[model samples]
Target: MDFQRTLLIGGLAIVGYLMILQWDKDYNQVPTTTQQQEQHQTVPSTEDAPQLTQAKQGASDDVPMLDSVADAPTDDTAADKQVVTVTTDTFAVEIDTKGGNIVKASLLKYPVKLPDDNEPNPAPFTLLERSSARTFIAQSGLIGPDGTDSKGKATYQAAQTNYQLNGGETLNVDLSLVDKKGVKVIKRYTFTKGSYEVKVSYVVDNTSSTTWQANLYAQLKRDNTQDPSNSSSSMGMSTYLGAAVRGKEERYVKLPFDEFEEEKFNADVTGGYAAVLQHYFVSAWIPNQEQLNNFYTRKAGSNNIVGFKNQNNPLKLAAGEKGEISATLYLGPKDQKRLAELADGLELTIDYGVLWFVAQPLFWLLTFIHSLIPNWGWSIILLTVMVKAAFYPLSAASYRSMANMRRLSPKLQEMRERYGDDRQKMSQAMMEMYKKEKINPLGGCLPILVQMPVFIALYWVLLESVELRQAPWLGWITDLSVKDPYFILPLIMGASMFVQQLLNPTPPDPMQAKVMKLMPIIFTVFFLFFPAGLVLYWVVNNLLSIAQQWMITRQIEGQAAAKSTK
Candidate 1:
């Protein structure tokens, strides 16, 4: 139970685990299909009508529904209609008049990158967009019996094409559609200052004699286009880019597009929501918490649609009734604080893998440190110091065990050489020597074994935290979430690892010694691709361990010198 040997084996095992993940990432890429997302265009025949992002089919049942441009005018093609633009302090969104749907959204606060200080970063990060090459947008409307969006996306008219929240608390961009019977449904998107949540509500003014009863549907649609937000797609094992929903079975469930072909995700959810998750951002539609919601996933054309509809409790209104039904739409960064406020489990979108329980506390601690330190890089170093301090007792015990083992290494080697191939005699001699020295071989390995999970969980915390994206530590290290551009930190980490290993007793087995010598090089290569924050943690830990081990080894050597003098 030599600690150095165990540590080598454990380190190599970790490298093997990472290799497996890299292999999966290399092979498990969702293949791009020859199928392009059918464009939202108008057609005459129901059979010839183009499939849209919605889950509904035109000829499905007694009520024929056509999804297009959620807009098809009986006379004029609405494709040429203008897109209403709404701007606030936080974001800019474009609403296509044909469907009165949110076709594009860009976060004003987040830029693509801050490459140089010469000029301000010009482009904001665009989350949702609809174009020839991409179709990732949020759509919401009234559907069911007398559904305004059922006939086709009824063309809506806006008072002004551009609306901006200038010195205002809230901005309301309304798209109004009127039926032949004079029923008007105003689809409104309300945005408050400094908020990512949009309250999308349908105001139904039933001017007809018949009652207007229609259910509300809100969904996120996207093509299998590359995730623009994920800068690490090429780095391997990119963060999850798919759909996540709060289901009846699990608090957080991911429904991949490929899974739809095999088995669709269908469930009746209450106080639940569905979201399209990407690298650092998310677009979710949270239906009424009290209403019975039908969550679904389907492959329409080349688009993957994940959404929820109030199917069980349709918005029923008597003739000439004035009523409304609404759902909250969140389109922004996956800010845990904002998301948690919107829904019960929406914050789970941050995704820290299987060790989320451990990762969460680590994040909370890191964030707490950041609040005090004000810089993420410095925060990470302090957090590392704090973590080391917390485990000081265990680490001290392990270091003492290693120091004793180091002191006994010569005699252990003597026993090995004296016994030669006499294995039984060599084992007996080693045990008797260990007992005489009063050193437990298992002492060092077990403490490190207990610390492994915490370190791994912290790795995930550094890898997954969006706050680390584009966050700078110091000169040349602009982003903590991505690999160090110059490979400086990893090299330092490797050097520290070698120094730490030199303080431990060498293995009696030459083959094990050789393998142990290469651990630093192997680990350095692995960390070359890891995010800078994680590498920083490892380097700091190794340096601190070396300081502690060196002192203990020195004390033991001094004691041995005193005994020889006596």
Candidate 2:
């Protein structure tokens, strides 16, 4: 085999990889119709309803205003200013000071929520809103008072314009609601300054003439309206946390539920619910386990109720009695180390799939390699080399098949001359000779076919693995998750394929040869749109394989020459 043929085959492999990549891009493009439907369905039905940024901007003339003032606080210096946000058109928070302590943060995940069970489609602007996924808001003008000697911790309860915490290392913020007579309703949230766990304790003093009963409730407001019926509609809730199939074999990765799923479940409960959407999987904590079976909903312009009701254990906060329901919310990647420290079953959100039995070890080894190299692209290169080395036995056999094909070329050509115009006789003679020589002509094809699945599995592993996203590889290539800006890697990949083709001996069939010749061109075009990281892996693998084959071919030629003399 010559280097050109080796390069050609390698180029084909890159092309093959790119073909899959481009098809995914063309057909599986983002900004789907489902998102648009969800956005459209979110239009306000009444004026009294909380005004969205759109309605306030006069973009929505049909929107009606409520007779009573909306729940949104008008006071710019509201105590929970961190939790309040106005639309770009209707409201804007003017931070008096920068780098201030964030007291009450309510990072709204969606732009708007619909009144009905219909979901809203996503707007391009809405998608852009999520570009800055991390939203943080805090109190301003408190820096001078922060480092004071008196308990420097900022308290959540105080409504003072400026606050200074005690000397304690941790601070607890509260969400207190007082009645007209200045009686506490909902207890304040005592969250540590920089932690997800909040120790919520409340003291409800009933100074009223009669005692009133209330239940402690927690709501995580989200928008789930979109035109789910439209296939083009792209709903945020669905895409944010939805199951996706991977690999050519269609491997499944199930997302966790956070909604009621029973048949008899009320529309109010089942219309829409919540579920945790992780970098990999989703686990939704619903009010009850029964909610899990009602409906697996994922359509835009349709309500997708998330967050189930606590079925197994529902805490009750009685009148004049205080009860606390505390849960540590996790808002980070599906990293195994970080997730392990959270709560029960939280780590399961990172779906490795059934192949995880083998894939996990492989992933760990690659991770170790990555930690040392400090570049995911290099990590993938290292991992591919290791995998190839492990499979060398089979690969060597495959290579030997090519070597044998090269050696038998002259003999096969002579035989064709001898048996000219006698098709049946020539076929019989070739089969007999193949059996006597014990040459496995099919050996090459078998090994290549066997490795194909492994290659595909690895491709999915790299694509879906969030750890590889935004991973760097020295210079020029910043994000492995996205395509390369310059087509250098892919072009090099094409050139390698062209070289591999030149190395491999030509087949007897002219038509087959022509088709093979065109493959590199087809693949080169395909690779133009493939993810840069994927193309990088193929380029490295091909370069290494080309070198390995060159050495092996020379050794085989030397052995054949020695045998021929004897």
Candidate 3:
């Protein structure tokens, strides 16, 4: 074909290839499969409801022991309510719209984050009540006149609103306590949604004259419902108190929720299990060491207790008195950059997974490169260009080989027609001819092989990079993290590939020629499920390569004409 026709065919092939990729993805139905282990697992117990222990009489007044009331019905099953559960490979969430609380959130993944849609059986945080998606409710019992006794149970109302988030939306959770005593306590929790850490501001107002005192605790609890028969049950649910601990050798210090208020104590056991949440780092509005003992966890399971410090001043609430305190909760994810943005010391929350040493540095470098440009899509484009440029010498060598092969096509065709049925002789002659021309037959394949690693690295960069979450590109490409709604980029990519194919003359070997002809179709099918941004990068690179090759081809033709004249 003439050069102009070659370019048109190549361009059209590429466009067609990309279009096929996009269309194939649309019809590609990812089969849903559940593990047999998951189906056989036993249901978790929502019973054993968490309760604060009170010292029985006859126990020393100074030493108050914590204990649970045995007969306090813990059955979570309610009449006439449909409970919806969402689970992943590691986590299971039981959302009860009837109770208005996430009754149980079992941590199947030791360190998990909000699930992404790409995950199989993704468990997302959803609004129980559609009428008010932001509204969340909890039941904390009423305070006695003295503020220490339970007059009755009072339900607490917490609502998370104004969630119109565009990358940097702040979470405002309003927590209120409504009681029959005409007493009310309204607290607000506010923090940027971009980071998982949270801050709480408590405002308690009581119209009663009786003094009221209440203790505050940050609760992080999960149910263990995994069937004992399943291997995952042992590794199922885990909680890190303030921060995630690194390495497998060190385990969490287990303490009971109640044991924290007392003086010095320690417990240790070899066999059974008990877990204590540890803070990789913590900042709290609590008191000093001199007033009370700092609580530590004993490896023992049976004697677990919470760590605590004595109150420096009474949370005194007289008639018509209002008390307010503001504290922050670092609910950070296991992502370093996000954790780091939670005011320096907060990055301790990112578990780093297993490969923190290597992954951390890679993440840092990716973040640094991304910071240079605000558009995440462009950042990816620039990153791809840099990588390709770094390996340009290899690519150039491959292109040069193809150029030489194209120049010798006329001579190779003559040999092919002359020795049509002499397969062995034709192969021998082809090799001898290549040696005479000083061209490497293996040249094109080596560079393509070397490009694989860079491609894999970039793939990980796009998949793991949280910075790209909800990030937008120019038009119709609102979320680079998700698939493109319009398949424009992929179509362009396929067209470019077809163009690149046309520029390089076909091989004389029948088998090799057949494979080359099918390269565009083979690649189009492969690119179907690839992220739109990734396909776009390939399209741009292919187009750039086609232009470069065309220029080289023209240069060779011009030189040959000049030599003929001389």
Candidate 4:
């Protein structure tokens, strides 16, 4: 086959693969409606109820609690609960006194997109909110046989309604809840300067004569609601919006909202975390790694909850003794480096599809380039150049093969005419001609096949990188994550593809040649709605390939002309 035909087949295969991916994302997805989730909700049985294991004699060990507590008071009690507001450099959070739950959180550094007619300043992006149409909050408390928290029923009183980190290094806010049995539980939230991770600690004070035993549970609760900022055009390439977990056995597992409605997910692992993942942000509860823990996913009313709890062992605090259980709660963007430092496999929440092995290193290279250039757009261009340079030798060989095929086109056509009635004779003549020229018929395709994965991986890297969101290149091109509003980059890419095709041998098959002629138009139209950064990468790659192929073809043609003259 000719190089142009091979290229056409490869392009069609890629397009088909992408179409299948989009189809699976749209049609094959199991919808998880609010009604369906409600239907799946069932009352917890006694055996399934979380219990604190009995404390050993003279053993003062801490017991782990499940991630979520059931039967928490509904919205009716929210009116009675005091709202404590905590402000830091990066976050503005509201904690409810009812259960010391983080009822609302707003990212102070990130602003929501404003309407065209709106004022210049936009409000901060709210990650957790409690409204009629949406409800998302972080809840944590103690639950066990002798626990005061009956599914987070017990209410707490915050020391203050407003707390601020006024140029200070760290801020601490405490909410105290005392039950009728004289068990005191203090929920303390610790915030550090310029950090998204909050240190949540539950200090249990056993004042009663008998031993006090309970388990600590922390969970994230959020209703199924689509993000308002996600545009309709990008819906086909929707980002993952559900739960993710990382454990010792399972490196990274996703429990989408639909799967949660189908059945409950239960697992036991040491040093694992459960998080609610969205496009660029993640909220997770990181439990103590040394302790055995249980990861769970379930539906509660209109909310989907994913969390982890301590194992069955109950924490025992003797009379007049105090014990503390704590976990880190991270609520922020999906910064891969930061997430990786937080826990193993947490960075996988970025979701680079199945080609993560290639995509990850590509991302690292892009990041390194960005560190020096200070712009994601230029970093992408330079990265594309680096990738092309790395594969230049292979591509040069492929181009040489195509040049040989183009040189032999006349002889091959003559053979076809000589053996017009015999298919076997024509095949034998073509093989002899190829052998005489020392040409490999399949040489061009193998290099392309090998490089295809890297190209696809780079495509995903550009599509999913949050760093490029709302970033700008030169004139007209802004927001590399979105499509080019003017559609100029895609057109340039198509033009480059057409020129590259012209420099290679044309297919003999009429239908194949026609398809090859139309590939540029087809791909141009397809890429019109693709991300501008991705289009930029393609345009640059095509231009580079054209330059290389043209040079190689010219060099081979010059050498052949000199030999003929001799």
**Each candidate's lDDT (Cα)?**
0.79, 0.45, 0.46, 0.77
**Per-residue alpha-carbon lDDT of candidate 1 for residues 352-471, written as tens digits (9 for 90 to 100):** 888899889999999999999888999999988988989998998999999988888888888888899898998888888889889898888889988888888887777777788789
lDDT of 3 at 117: 67
Error of 3 at 401 (Å): 1.2
> Per-residue alpha-carbon lDDT of model 3 for 131-182, expressed as tens digits?
1111111111112233221322223444432223344456354546655566
Ranked candidates (lDDT, high to low): 1, 4, 3, 2
What's the true lDDT of residue 158 in model 3?
41
Specify the highest-TM-score model's number: 1
Which residue segments of model 3 deviate by more than 4 Å?
Answer: 1-195, 198-334, 339-366, 525-529, 560-566
Top candidate (lDDT)? 1
Model 3 worst lDDT window (10 residues): 127-136
Tens digits of lDDT, candidate 2, 487-565: 6787788889887776565675668889889887777767665666778878887887777666667788789899989
Model 3 superposed RMSD (Cα): 13.7
Compute the lDDT for candidate 3: 0.46
lDDT string for model 4 (231-283, tens) is 42263367778888975577799888877768777887877788988766888
Q: What's each prediction's TM-score?
A: 0.84, 0.59, 0.48, 0.81
Which has the higher TM-score value, candidate number 3 or candidate number 4? 4
Error of 3 at 238 (Å): 26
Off by over 4 Å in 4: 1-79, 114-119, 227-236, 410-425
Q: Once model 3 is optimally superposed onto the true structure by TM-score, how far is the C-alpha of residue 540 displaced, in angstroms?
A: 1.8
Superposed Cα deviation of residue 493, candidate 4 (Å): 1.7
Q: What is the lDDT of residue 33 in candidate 3?
A: 20
